[model samples]
Target: MERFSNITEALMNEAKIEIESFDIKDGEKIIAYFSEIPSISGFPYKIILVENSDGIVYARFRQWDTEYDFTRWDNGVYNLDRLRIITDEKILSQTESALLKEYLSQLEKIHLPENINKENVIILDSSLWKFGFILKNKNIDYTWKAATEDINVFVPLINLMREKYLDRI
Candidate 1:
């Protein structure tokens, strides 16, 4: 079985882009990051949220095509190629940005326990969800197979983003 960190590293390497690569002004920093590594039957994409010192927020969405060699999967490698930018560093309006920031704040308050057992879930074709957040004194990173209801807390944020930005794509 492949470790979740290894899978995340592979996906990040394949992306050729890192969250730190975004231009951050003196008072601006990345507040949160979310990514979905889809199963063989789903689409692959990532969403990043950044906020300035003034609480202004911006979002960027990147997607990739699955047109790569399937043989590499035997080695636990996912070939996510043909990069697509559904939303590129777009600044959200004040109202939407405030709402997004609120959602991020809510996520910060929720504590997802570590080492969740996956044996209970048996979905064969579920996506893997990853989330990262930078807080005042600590950073949080979590990943879980999308086969359990425990991860549903994130659904609202995902749905909001999808409805606001991804619906067109």
Candidate 2:
């Protein structure tokens, strides 16, 4: 693994480890919290991803402490419409697993956007929450969180995951 000086490299390594151990087991979940330039109300948005047995996955997107929202997508083969409508449990058909696997593979290729500078910046405010990821299963849970005023790496990954969850991958 690369050293911690590069935040994006470190996060990609950590995410790969968690993804390897995930196994897509029933009830396994990976939740992430990201703080973009804080909203006018001063809260960060949250993203939750739930993966169930047989490669089933569900995603929820919500503004900080508010109701859920979803983007519209052209109905595709192996639809997740029910999950989209109810924002709950649903399964992707076998044919969809290939696409899902491709998405997962993209995670391995995550690179810090060329436009983002690697130089670090310190945040004087102690109250700001850093971007973080939490991995949990029936037996154990682990998390890695970082607080930073700079958006060195997270913005791209967050955007990628958001697109994937919205079926725009």
Best by TM-score: 1
Deviation in Å, model 1, residue 82 alpha carbon? 7.1
Supply candidate 1's per-residue lDDT for 2.
35
Q: Distance (Å) between predicted and true CA of 10, model 2?
A: 30
lDDT of 2 by residue, 112-162 (tens): 232332235554432232344432222212222333334433545455445
Considering only N, C-alpha and C atoms within 3 Å, which residue pairs clash in candidate 2?
130-147
lDDT of 1: 0.61
* Candidate 1 lDDT tens digits, 112-147: 555432667676767777776676667777777843
TM-score quality measure for candidate 1: 0.62
Q: Give the candidate number with the greatest lDDT.
A: 1
Q: Please provide TM-scores, in order, for all candidate models, with all chains considered together.
A: 0.62, 0.34
RMSD of 2: 16.0
| Candidate 2: stretches off by over 4 Å | 1-26, 31-43, 65-100, 106-119, 122-157, 164-169
